[model samples]
Target: MKVISDLEIAQTLHLPNECEELQLLMMKYECAMTEMITKLEVLSSEMSLKFQRNPFESIRCRLKSPQSIYDKLCSHGYEVSYQSIRDNLNDIAGVRVVCSFIDDIYLLASTLKMQDDLLVIQEKDYIIQPKNNGYRSLHLIVMVPIFLMKEKEYMKVEVQFRTIAMDFWASLDHQLKYKRADIADADAISEEMKISAELVSQLDNHMLQIRERIDAGEK
Candidate 1:
């Protein structure tokens, strides 16, 4: 018989009383995210060599913290049950892929979707149609199989594909969102950021056209 850890029991019981349990479960989620990241790394490396061009600039992974999970559940008006956490939260594990060019973002996303083992649960193309706040990225919710010693577990992860300029814009915008501010000043800042996003979008398109012309001349 296998002895289950406190965290394993907590997962089954759906009680958030024990801090250690939440910590252990989050660690396991982190491990799952790590496995997915490694898979993406291999795919990116092989594709770069085959195409003679690197499609991705960088890959990053993160596991949401226990506090964040709890807050999210509360925000959605759900009870803080372990099952609710699993069922309601689709982004417990997240991966961010930054690309050198705008075209590279779509290319990488299509390649990932073609993988047999990964299942695309949902997709939001914020690139083609930017959000009201001027946010843009290709977001994919995918389920990946992770094999363990005893059995295999399928985990849901949010994968975001974006150009370097898009990533930079998002990073700055995230900082602005977290800061406390007056209403009038915040509206002005948001409008300025929207203008910045438009400029960045134009730059991405211009760079893509230049790269395409260069490739065309070589061929």
Candidate 2:
């Protein structure tokens, strides 16, 4: 894999002389993360062109390590370790594809999976099975290769597929849930969110139907 230059790693860590060793170690992780994100972006663009769909609205990738790794190293005990960060990254390597209609999400996801370069490690069809919190989207863990001057290494990245309507509702839910402590009962809020989600789903289906009908007439 591409070995990151020591200077670049140093600049990113910004650690003092006392923490020079840790800085070097952190650089390897950072380089791996940077490479993963770059590959994801390229894949996203290619998928967009192949499927005649808009590119991802937003794409991000991250790396993490467990707290035990740090503890075993006998280094300073950081509240957040690389492993924890990596876990969170896996949870959110979110690639939101905001389309004009909801069916576009499924189309885009299916098209992406067909690419040979991308290896699907796991998939959670949240669109088909949304979370109890009304979270809706397709979560896929994909492994992509990053070619360096010396070698090539594969990195895992999480990709989340969602539509504009779903994004809007999720954003609002997050803001409202965090803004107030004792706002409403969790179940009550969840039920309301579910109702909204169903409405959005119906709207997506209706729009797709309209498009199909128009295409039929043109033909």
Candidate 3:
């Protein structure tokens, strides 16, 4: 058995906890989140092999707690409380998966949801029901079990599946919007962003059609 040193764990967490109870709690959460990410990565790789699809271009998993949540709340002039973070984490146990095409995004999401051990807490088919901002992807909140030496705990994992094209546009939009928030041409840039979003949507549909044709020929 490989043992992770306490020092290594401490380095990863970065936050100092005065109470032993809090330290243990933080360690447990970190370990559980890391294990969940590893499981997801394995699933992603297996899926790529099974479908002969390109490996996921990128996948990210994150775990946030009440303190971190409270900081954000305070920054936004909201109540600074532990419960707020807990509530937010309950809603956003996130994983972002980037794929080669729109169809692959759906197919990968479906494959992951089919795993018997993974319990789907909720699902939002954003690709089919995109937000008004033109965000396109599948979002699923799932519960995965983590086994410790003598116990098992359930952890929430959020999965967001998207295509490379969608990611590219989103990345650019995020950078420009945030980096140039005070620019005089921001309104003009926003309009162009909306147009680009629509183009990505059209491209997604066209790619999906091509994939359907390929599947039909395989049948």
Model 2 lDDT per residue over 168-214, tens place = 88788888776554765866776887898888777767877997798
Q: Rate the local accuracy (lDDT) of all candidates.
A: 0.81, 0.59, 0.67
lDDT of 3 by residue, 1-219 (tens): 123344533443332332344344445555655665686688777876887766478877665543454456666665433234334454334568887777677667777678787788889887788776666778888777777789987766677788888888888877777866888997777877878888998987888799879978997
Q: Is candidate 1 or candidate 2 better by TM-score?
A: 1
- Candidate closer to the true structure by lDDT (higher is better), 1 or 3: 1
Q: For model 1, how does the per-residue alpha-carbon lDDT over 23-53 read when each residue is reduced to its tens digit?
A: 5455656666787788788877898888788
Residue pairs that clash (backbone atoms under 3 angstroms), model 1: none
Q: Give the TM-score of candidate 2.
A: 0.65
All models, RMSD in angstroms:
4.2, 6.5, 4.9
Cα error, residue 5 of model 1, in Å, equals 12
By TM-score, the best candidate is 1
Model 1, residue 89: C-alpha shift (Å)? 0.1
